[model samples]
Target chain A: MSENQSILVIGADPAGLQASKDIAEFGFRVVLVEKRDELGGAPIRWKYHTLAPDFVPTEKVLGPLIDFVKNNKLVIIYSSSIVDSYEQKDDYFKVRILNLKNKSVSYEKVSAIIIATGFEHFNASLDPRYGYGINPNVIGINELEIMLSNGKIVRHDGKIPKRIGFILCVGSRDKATNQWCCTVCCGISIKQAIEIKKILPDAQIYVIYMDIRTIGLWEKLYWKSMEEYHINYIRGRVGENTGQEKNYWLKEKIRLLEDLLKLCLI
Target chain B: MSENQSILVIGADPAGLQASKDIAEFGFRVVLVEKRDELGGAPIRWKYHTLAPDFVPTEKVLGPLIDFVKNNKLVIIYSSSIVDSYEQKDDYFKVRILNLKNKSVSYEKVSAIIIATGFEHFNASLDPRYGYGINPNVIGINELEIMLSNGKIVRHDGKIPKRIGFILCVGSRDKATNQWCCTVCCGISIKQAIEIKKILPDAQIYVIYMDIRTIGLWEKLYWKSMEEYHINYIRGRVGENTGQEKNYWLKEKIRLLEDLLKLCLI
Candidate 1:
């Protein structure tokens, strides 16, 4: 509770930004650090077109957090920085951060430390059957998100897809992968599918999932997508995406749709 | 599970529509009746602009139900009609519906009945302090929803208000009223508040509440409204609207902002 005591918040994402502001507003100096040159983290910097469940723009979602962090005088932002070392000194942490912006290192003694490095989207390239990096039409959810955020919901050839497909459980909840549900991808797919439908109303959207994890009130979005958008929900993971244009096979005729786009969301 | 058995569904609202469709899909005859000229109860017909928790268009919310009702041959709809009387036989109920369109009563023997009349907004006029009917600047949440749905989010005089205030617990949860918390009101106010903010970004929005009942997953909307939109949350209900052009009482000073609008939601 001492005014001189400080809190070191590593990563200036929503959590870190909020923690820094909340702590700083309570008469404590906060050293908020992030590796990105700008703040707002992945959800703001990248994978935020429309937020899940609500479908409002990411800008509106991150607006207040950004404003609070930017205006708080007590929050000292260390962009393009990382907490390199930590030493526990009795009741406090003596932390050394490599400040890449200044080409220098700085040390801070803080009563508490909050580690908020955020997360990395699963590397879809590791699972090659989907032909992620190999096929021009196949992309990961994060990539699709960035594309959608920038108003680029189309194939690499700059053609609007007549049918878009989402293969859920890309890296998570698999025997070979993390063996746990991502818990977020289902809602993301539902949200993105709705957005895509909004953009291309006649576009046939499909979700290939092991199970739609949208439970409780979040199920509203999934229901809305299925009922209103007429989004097709196939209860299986897509085994492959051949490099051939208009690939067709039995029930896999869904993959043969012209100008097809696929999102491998883990 | 006899195929010949029928179910009588009252009130062609979302619930009735869904019940009728569901029963009909299961190979049962459904007699769906509504006193209203059209389908979709109040939420669709009168109050819903953008639904809570997600904020999508009401048309999208009601679209699938409408589609299901329209396409199902087993689901017979009777608009401008009401369930006039019910007589129980050995097991099934012999129901008489007064067909207002034909000026005659028709009888139907059905196995069961489903009443989906839905809810009515508490008459804000009953709470005279809010000045709902008397004041031009004052309105209820239903009015605001209709306005939002129809792209008419403006004052009675056709001017956009720079400041909007919402008084929660308009009739419910009070000594003089129903004395039960209308759980939907809190989420409704939060959703409307956010929508208002989206429409008029510079508008100073306020929610005067006994308690904001948005809980669990629905809490996300409340958080977004407060954190992102900077909507102010006052802890007490407004005591008066006085029918004054610019009510300048101390607490009523919030209502005195230039181009002010007030919504009372029970």
Candidate 2:
């Protein structure tokens, strides 16, 4: 745990920043590298919906990530795409780091390496039926993240749509694409639903999904979104949205009530 | 919207708080009532994990809620429950209030009612095979919440059990029971799996779910939990939790993964 002992961390995201903080805290010299232009790679954030008065602001959940990097005395390289340049000495190896912005490269000898590169988002356009790239309404989770952060709600046509239909499992949990479930979707959807409902109280939200994968206490948030926000979740796959007529959108709007409340289905 | 008018809120949860704040801000007196002694009817916090380094501290999330109450002049009635509450009058409603601690009942007149009464937790003990009540290791979602917050990392026993299993659709999505997805179970389970993996690093966590219902960007959190947490999942139901193994207590513990990480059939 000496300053001379170097730690090279690839990828300057949450994992990389966290590693940098831990290493520096333990008296280790850490140098972080990112292929992206800036930090907070992939523009991904995980959240669950919460109800607030007057849609007032709550906590910035990622404050810790920012504080970690800011407090940690670690070298950070941005807009640099370090590539396969390594020098083999008698006992260890030296790595070559490249700076894409300046078109300059540098070599650094490190004792240890940490590869915290995160995963890529599953393309919703693969299904084609989901219409992620084709339809103005359909957007991936990352794009949705950006929109939610803007603090202003807008629809595909510039005017806010009265009804927004969110379809889950676009490219996830499909046997053809990937059998594994993307675990955070349930929370994210619930969080987004809460936000949408808060911003537009009267707007109708239809969530068509194969399943609602909310487990643990977080299950409470799912029901919170529905019971509080009045969101309607119907179990079904996305069957090619034809862009319905204005009158039909109002007429077809369904009231989802659990007969359990009445002890009978109407 | 006058100070003379008293608004009767059905429950003192998040939604009730918002309603009371809005109405009271408009120059109306608000009465917040809850059947429970404490606030936060359902404890589904966002962006929280026990062992996860990225978990945000409580000061950040709850700070706003605290600030709002201080700024707004409001009345909160604790240890009080509402009974026979409805719009009994044209301008004002006759509401019955009960003090559970003292077994005293009284009546109050109010202008409006907001039903923020959250849903009751699922009674998983009804099913004996699940060992909800019979087994020490087995517990419902609410109990798990307490254990998690109080640090039940390893399991019931001091030694970290090699395997951990989460059975989804416990009180929800069960046809014979509520017949509806409590809706948050799936994502909560995934987040729990990630959390469990974080605490036990090598502990085998399996989420046995019929389906994963993550809507939109919420699917992003689901994916993060699955891909990053290294938590394994099984697409099967636990008919029962009966077996005699290393210990009599651990025997009741559900066996989810044989070799967790590698995913061995045997």
Off by over 4 Å in 1: A1-266, B150-152, B243-245, B248-258
What is the C-alpha local distance difference test score of each model? 0.77, 0.59
Give the Å error, residue A121, model 2. 3.7
- Judged by lDDT against the true structure, how good is candidate 1? 0.77
RMSD of 2: 19.2
lDDT (C-alpha) at residue A63 in model 2: 52
Report lDDT (Cα) of residue B119, candidate 2: 56
Number of the top-ranking candidate, with lDDT as the measure: 1
Candidate 1 is graded, for docking, as incorrect
Q: How many backbone clashes does candidate 2 have?
A: 29
**lDDT for each residue of candidate 2 in A1-266, tens digit (9 for 90 to 100):** 23567788888766776787788776767777788765655433322122122222222433566566656666555445764577777655598888887878877777788998855677666666544566565565555555666755676667766766666666666767765566656566666767867777987777766666666555667777887889887655545544433211222354332100100000
TM-score, each model?
0.48, 0.47
Predicted candidate 2 versus true structure: per-residue lDDT over B1-266, tens digit per residue: 34677777777555676676777666777777777766544543321322122344333434455355446666545445656445477667888887777778777778777778865666676655566665566655555545456565544555556876777766555546664565555655665566556667877676666676655444656778777876665555566655334221223354443221111100
